[model samples]
Target: MFIPYCISLYIIKGNKSIYDPAFRLFALNMGFADLEFMALVGIFPAVSYFLPFPVSFNVCKVFGAFSADAWFTCIMLSQMMSLNRFVGIFWPGNAKAIYTKRNTTITLAFCWIQGLIWTSFYLKPNVGLYFDSKNRGLIYDFRLNGTETVFSLNMIFNYVHASSLCLTYGLIYLKIRQDITEPYRLTIFHHFIPVHDKKDVSYEDNILEYKEIMAAPDLNTGWRRKHMLDPKLANDRKKENKVLIQACVICLLHVAAVATWAVSQKIATAKYVLFIPSIVGLFSSGSTGYLYILVNSTVRQKFASMVSKCWCHKANQLSNYEARKKDSGIQSISPKKDNEYSELMEMDDYENVTKN
Candidate 1:
C-alpha cells in the first residue's frame, strides 16, 4: 500500500502537464494524509503489539493524536474532492475561476488547520485518544469513563462528510443525465454540461489538461499541452467523466469503512469483532493509491512507465556488473598465461643453446 501510494504520488507530481493544479493539490494532500494515517494509526500500533515490551499509554496517545489529525484531514480532503468534481461538471464555465491555485491552496490550509484543532480536543488528559493493542482499536478515554461525547462528535463529522458527498454526487448524476439523452445511460458523455453557444464551452478554461495528447509522444520523454477545438476530440470531457467515476468509487469505499467503524464502536463488545473495523479502515486507506492507478488511465500509464524504466535500469546495471566481472577474470588469466609462455620460450632457447 505504501509503495503503491508513493508511486501514485510520484507519477502525479512528476507529470504536472498531465494533471490540473487544483486536482494535483488535492491529490498530494490526500496521499500524504493517508500515508501518515496508515503509518501512525495502522502500522505503528500493529507493530507495537508484537514488541517485547509493552507500549506506554502516552506513546499510544501521541501516535493516535497524529493519526486522528491525518484521518480528519483525509476526510475533509475527500469531501473537498467531491465538491471539486461537482463544480467541474455542473459549472464548467465558472470552475476555472473558482478553483484557481490560490483558492485551492487556501482551502487545503484550512482543512489542515481544522484537523489540528479537532485533534487538540482529544489530546486533553481527561479526554484522550490512543491505540489499544489489547483491544485492537483506537480507544477514546473520556472523563467519568463516558466515551459517548467523543463518539457523537466523530459520528457527526462522518455524517456530514458522507451526506455532502452523496448530495454532490447526486447532483452530478442528475446533470449528466439531463445532458445525455441517449438510451444507454452508461455511455461516455461527449459534453458534461450544456452551453447555449458552443463557443461558451471553453474546455481549456475549466480543468487542467486531463487527457494525453493522442498525437503527441508518450509521457516517458515529456509532453506539451494541447487543446482540442472539436467537442468529440476534446479529451477534457472524457477525462472529466473518468474523474467523476474515480471520485465516486473512492467515496463509496471510504463510506463503507467509516460505517464499519461506527457500527463496531456502538455494538461490538468482543475483541475479535473490534479488530474487523481496524482492518477495514486500513484497507480503505491503503486502497486509495491503487484506486487512482486503476481509475485514471493517465496515472496507470505513468505508473507502468515508471516501473518499466526502473526495471530496465536495474537490468542494465546487472549486465554491466557481470560484464566487468568477466573482463577482470579474463585479464587476470591472461597475465598468468603470458608468464607461462615466456618461461616456455626461455626453456626452448636454453635447450637450443645446449644442443649447439
Candidate 2:
C-alpha cells in the first residue's frame, strides 16, 4: 500500500491533488521511513516465526541495533512534522523558505545519522533480544545491569520531543483562532515611469498579483477554517485544510501508537498490549499513504484510473487471443502477450515453472 501510494503521489502530483509539493514529499518520506522501520523490526521476527532460525544473542543485538536506528529516526521525524506545520501556519511567508527540498533532504539525512548515534546508547551490557513463541516475534528484555540510566535518558528524550510537538501544534491552533477573530491582509504595488523623450515622461501605476497568507473569514464554525466569497479561493482553502487535517490525524495516531508501545514495554501488567508495540511504528510509517488514498479525491481518481487501465489491458489480451483463434481456426496462440512490467515480475515464476 505504501509502495503504490508513494509512487502515485510522485507520479500523479499530490500537491495539485490537495496541498503543496512539500506536504507530498513529507508523506512520501514518512512512508519510506515506515518501510525502513518495518524491514528492520519485522523481517527477522517473521522469518524466525516460520523457520525457527537459531540466531545467536550477538546476531539479535546486531538486528536490534538496526531497529534502534529506525526508532530514533521516527522520533526525529515527528519533530520535523511539528516544525513543518508550525512554519506553514504561523509563519506562512517563510514556509517555503524553510521547507525547501534541499533543506528537507538534509534534515532527513541528519535524522537518520542521528538515529545511528542514538542507537549506540542502546548497545548495553544486559539488554538481550530473542525470538519467542509466546509473542511469535522478538522479545526484548533487560537483566540486572547498571545501564538502566541510558534507557531512562532515552525515555526522557522522547518525552521532550513529544512536548515540543504538542507545543508547536498548540501554538498553530491558537494562531488559527486569532486569524478568525482578527483578519489580516498583505498587499504589494508597483509604479513605473516611461520616458519617450528627454523633455517628456509618463508615469504608470501597476498592480502585481498578490496572495494573502490568511484570508478574512465572514464567520463560520467553532473557530474558522477559511471564509469563502469566491469559488476558487474557497476550493484552495478546502484543499489546504484537507491535507492539514489528514496530517494532524496521522501524527496523532502515530504518537498515540508509539506511546502505547512504549508503555507496554515497562508495564508488565498490560503484556497483552505487546501487539501494539510491534505494530505502532509500522502503522505510523504507512498510515499517511492510506489516508491520502481514502481522503484525497484526486489521488483516489488517479488510483482508480490505474486499476481500470490494468483490467482493460488484461481484457484486451484475452479478447485478442480469442479473435486470433476465430480468424485462423486455431485453439491457442504459441505465446501469451504481457506488458513489460508483467514480464519482469513473472520472470522468476517462469523459471520456477520450468524447473518443476
Candidate 3:
C-alpha cells in the first residue's frame, strides 16, 4: 500500500507525458490488492495466533473468500504489468494506441469483476474451506463437507495465482534475455570491424565510437540501435534490466513457495511452507515502486524534497515550542551560544521570510 501510494503520488506530481496509464492502473490495483491480502490473510492468521477466543468457522470462510479475491486481483494486475512492459518494449509505436488510459482502466475494472465472480463461490454459509487444520478444525465441517469436489473453487484460485505468477516471470526472463543478448550482438559486431593501424586507431576508441554511432538513430530509420554499443545507453539499459530481473526473481520465489506448499498438502503433510514465501512475496511486490525510484530522476528528487519538507516541518515545530518555553521563563536558555543552534535559527528565519 505504501509502495503504490508513493508511486501514484510520483506519477501525479511528476512528468505526465512519460507516465503510462497502464502502469498507473497497475499501481492502483497493487495498492488495493496488498491491502486486501494483508488484511484478510496476514492479519487474520496473526489474530488466530494470539487470541484465546474460539475462532469462528464462518470467519475462516470469509478469510478464504477475501484471500482468493485479493490473490487473484494481484496476479491479474501483475500479468497486466508484464504485458504492458512487453508492449512498450516490443511495439513502442503501437503501445500508445493499444494501451490508452480508458482501455487500461476498463481492463482493470474487468479484472476486479472477474476476481469478485470467483470469490462469490466461497460466500455461502457452507463453503467449508479450511486452509489448515491447526487454525481451523472439524468445527468448519458443514453441509458442503462431503458434497464439495476435490477440485474446489479455492483450489482453482490457488492454481491460477501460481500459474499467472510463473507465466509473468517467464515472459520477463525472456524479455530481459532478449534485450541483453541483442546488445551483445552489437558489441560483437563492433569488435569484428578491421583496423589497419590498431595503434593510431586505438581499439578502445574504435569501440567507443561504434557505441556512440549505435546509441541513437536518425528519424529516417525506424530501427532502434542496441544500447550495448553506447556506454551511456548500455548503463541505462543495465539499470532497467536490473529492475526487471528483481521483479522476475520475486515472481519466481512466489511460484516456488506456492508450489512447495501445494506439493506438501498433496502428500498429506501438515507443513505450511507457503507462509514464508507469502511474506517474502508481499515484500517483493514493492519492487515496482523501488524501480520507479531507481529509474525516474524526477521521482527521486520529489522523494528527497518530501523527506526534507517533513524534517524541516518537525524542526520548525520544535524550535517554536522552545522559543515559547524560553519566553514564558518555563525553560532556561543555555548560557553557551552553540554554533549549530545559531545556524539552525538563521536558517529557520530565512525560511520564514521566504514563506511570508
**Best-performing candidate as measured by TM-score:** 1
Ranking by TM-score: 1, 2, 3
Q: Estimate each model's TM-score.
A: 0.73, 0.67, 0.60
**Model 3: CA > 4 A from native:** 1-18, 130-133, 136-243, 267-281, 284-301, 304-356
Q: Give candidate 3's TM-score.
A: 0.60
Of 2 and 3, the candidate ahead on lDDT is 2
- Estimate candidate 3's RMSD in Å: 11.8
- Measured with C-alpha atoms, the lDDT of residue 291 in candidate 1 is 81
What are the Cα lDDT values of the candidates? 0.72, 0.59, 0.58
Candidate 1: C-alpha lDDT: 0.72
**Residue-wise lDDT of candidate 2 within 1-356, one digit each (tens)?**
44764655564453343455566555556555666777766766667556656656677666776677776777677677777877877778899988888988888788778988866755665655433445544445656363456557666777777667677776777776676555522211111112134453323211111111122222131112223223344444455566566766765765676586557667633545566667766676666667777776666655655666677687774344455677888964453322333335335444453344
Local accuracy of candidate 3 as per-residue lDDT tens digits, 277-348: 445545544444655555555455555555655776877743444556767877556533233443454456
TM-score of 1: 0.73
Worst 10 residues of 1 by lDDT: 221-230
